[model samples]
Target: MMIKDIKNYLKSVVDCPNWYVGRIDGKKDQCIGVYPARSQPKPVPIAIGGVENTTYNKLGVEILIHWGDAPTDAEEKAQAVYNALYGQNPEIGGKRVIKIDLNTSCPVYAGVDENGIYEFVLGAVIYYER
Candidate 1:
């Protein structure tokens, strides 16, 4: 559900048409892949009995942008995605997103793949209500 939320959000925000979850479509030279990386629960102290309750979840998401033999296109698309996602709190897929922040300052170049497609990767942490 989180993956679907992320993928749908990206599809709505980013201009690119091809958006996939878990794996990239090999047929499409230019596309984006949204994958789950790591996650943790965000617990808060409750007033009653000083108990900790998890009201939100922090999820790590990895976004991969691939363009056919065009590093610039890949990087540009990655930047667009970064701009669309970073430092934003929006409700998507019926989930209340608290925040989204990039793990790195910019998209990291992942070099060319075996299919000769250029790739750029973005790591982000997304906080949302449980």
Candidate 2:
């Protein structure tokens, strides 16, 4: 449910047609990977110090924006994502985005994939509550 919530939130907030979860492939205008960080155990819905289920869930997302050939275009798309999501709380697809704390955004990289598409990549922690 959190995965769907996060994917829907990304799509709604970014207004892009290519939002995805878990994997990125094909020729999408945008791609998102919402997964638990490999460095830590997956987050659980149970409250940190209590047995009861909490309304909040938190996880990291790896975001990639592809703009075909131009680095500037990719940067523009990345900026749009940052503006829409960074540090803002928004309700999306019945879930509430409590906060989006950006971790890092890489510079526009050329030939990011075999398709030679220019891309800007970012990582963030998404906090949400239903």
- Highest TM-score scorer: 1
> Largest lDDT belongs to which candidate?
1
Model 1, C-alpha of 10: deviation from truth (Å)? 0.5
The lDDT for every candidate, in the order shown, is: 0.82, 0.65
Point out where model 1 deviates above 4 Å.
38-53
Candidate 1 clashing pairs? none
User: How does candidate 1 score on lDDT?
Assistant: 0.82
> Candidate 2 at 66: error in angstroms?
2.2
lDDT of 2 at 59: 68
TM-score of 2: 0.71
Per-model TM-score versus the true fold: 0.84, 0.71
Positional deviation of residue 39's Cα in model 1 after best superposition, in angstroms: 6.8
lDDT per residue for candidate 1 within 1-130, as digits (tens), equals: 3887888988988887688999988678889999987553344345454434556666778989987787788888889988988778888778898988788999999999888999998888787776
